[model samples]
Target: MNLFDYTRADTLGAAVGAEGALLAGGTNLLDLMKIGVATPSRLVDVTRLPLTRIEEHEGGGLRIGAMVRNADLARHPQVLARFPAVAEALLSGASAQLRNAASTGGNVMQSTRCPYFMDPLSPCNRREPGTGCSAIGGETRNHAILGWTTGCIATHPSDLCVALAAFDAVVEIAGPSGTREVPMATFHPLPDANGVAPALAAGEIITHIRLPDPGGMARHARYVKLRERTSFAFAIVSAAAGVEVAQGRIVNARLALGGVAARPWRCLDAEAALLGQPPTEDAFARAAEQALEAAAPSGDNAAKIVLARRIAVRALSLAAAGTPDRMPALPASVFEGDVHG
Candidate 1:
């Protein structure tokens, strides 16, 4: 690893003003540093800043500090009792030890786990823009199936992001320009004609994440992850589904997909299809089909189109039945030998 200067910031202003990569838990940043994928001249430690609390907002929503550890957030009584899908998504990721060291802000800011991106010799546009993407024509089974360009097809590997999208969470940022709020759906940018951009601008720091009230859909929310293995594996395709039903018909629905796009892919069309419709297998299947209509799968990842639809239907069904506590197991047939890093 390259030698670098390190400083711990005791305040948000001090942390954001420092000229280096901000470090919270070092869960992802340190790994990237050791692999030579990220070489920072200095490290700004923000874990000591006053951003570790999880509190209820004035509007009945929740405000979670960016530095809050993943394990603590996942097991928080209010989070488990209200945003069950968020809790499930956080618990489904990584291992217990890693989760304990991963911060909420760091989780969303982590780089893609694509082998090409991590390997210094490989040509990955995300790692070095204009180098071209090796995953485009090499070992692409785990690549993206939606909103990808020839320049890059990498996917964000955050389970928490998918649930945040479903809940319509907002990101609170502090930067040189002062504080600002960005909706979670718009925070992560796609690498298309618009160009690749980090969720936060340079010198910007995430202070906290704001989650809107679920409106009684908390008990009717579910997160389903389909991975090569039951544990410690990144998802091949995952779904975060939340629905509010009345008299056997859906009143509101929120669906977000992960492990299949550059960011947490929100299925607004699917949600629209579910509203006012009965929460039946047929209805769920139709919504799933509508959700995948925009998919632009690469040759090797075409299977994701089918797999994502199946997972979406299953997740929605579980949510509609108000069984967020039940974890559904994926059948072996769904694996198809496509493992994620």
Candidate 2:
């Protein structure tokens, strides 16, 4: 095993200034380290820092500290009432025990950088420059169908990020230079952008996640994922959708997809399509078409393109139906909503 120094950071500054992997809950980091996928020489433990508060933001939204556990955030009264999609995304991930131990920031950071991850023995062009993406010619039934390049056909696996991206969540990051905020949509690398091989910038640590006021969309939002199993599984295709309907017309809409791209696939065109339209299956189908307009199969995963489109429509239809009085016992289940789309 590779040797590494371990330090428990007592302050946010100490965690930022430390030059290595920032350990929050260590749910994904520890697993990656054990498999030799991550070999940081130093582990900066940031769990004890005073970054666990969940408070109301100035914009009438919630400012969630990075260290807040997934379970806590999902169950927070404000989160459940105002941002049910975010809560549903959290509840759909892993299991009760894993959610209890996983941090909000860690879940965003845990998104995969390569399609062929979890196998350290495989060579990765993203991990080591010019090595070439192994998944390019290998198993791609579960790989990307959008925003993939010859260098990588990676997929982001964060369910929280999909909901966060749809609602314009901002990531508050701290570093030697100081703290700054980035929208969750841009927090991770985009398919067409030059991105870090490793997800985070060097020496920077996420301190908080700032969610904007959901406004009308808060009452009508949903997160749905098509996973092989009912629980503890990654999405084959997932969608987070929110719409503001007034006088039987959509005034605003937000749509984002996961398990299809390097980052949560925000459907700006899809959002635009839904605007001024009645909240109906026909409108959602048009938006779904717009969402997948740029998508192309990287390899043999052409079916994901069809599945992605269907889920976008499903999520939008469910969002228009309004959030449930209580979260469904089975998130992302077809049986949970009135309209399956």
User: Top model by TM-score, which number?
Assistant: 1
Q: State the displacement of the C-alpha of residue 93, model 2, in Å, after optimal TM-score superposition.
A: 0.4
Off by over 4 Å in 2: 111-115, 191-196, 327-341
Stretches > 4 Å off in candidate 1: 193-195, 324-341
Q: What TM-score number comes out for model 2? A: 0.93
- Which residue pairs come into collision in candidate 2? none
User: What's the CA RMSD for each of the models?
Assistant: 7.3, 6.2
Clashing pairs in 1: none
lDDT of 2 by residue, 1-341 (tens): 47999889998767876887888889999888887888889888888888777787887899888888888788777888889999999999999999989998899889484546667777675566566677877888778887788777878889999999999999998878887888998778754323336546678888889998999988899999999999798999999999999999999999999999888989998899888999999999999998999889888899999999999999999999999876433332322222111
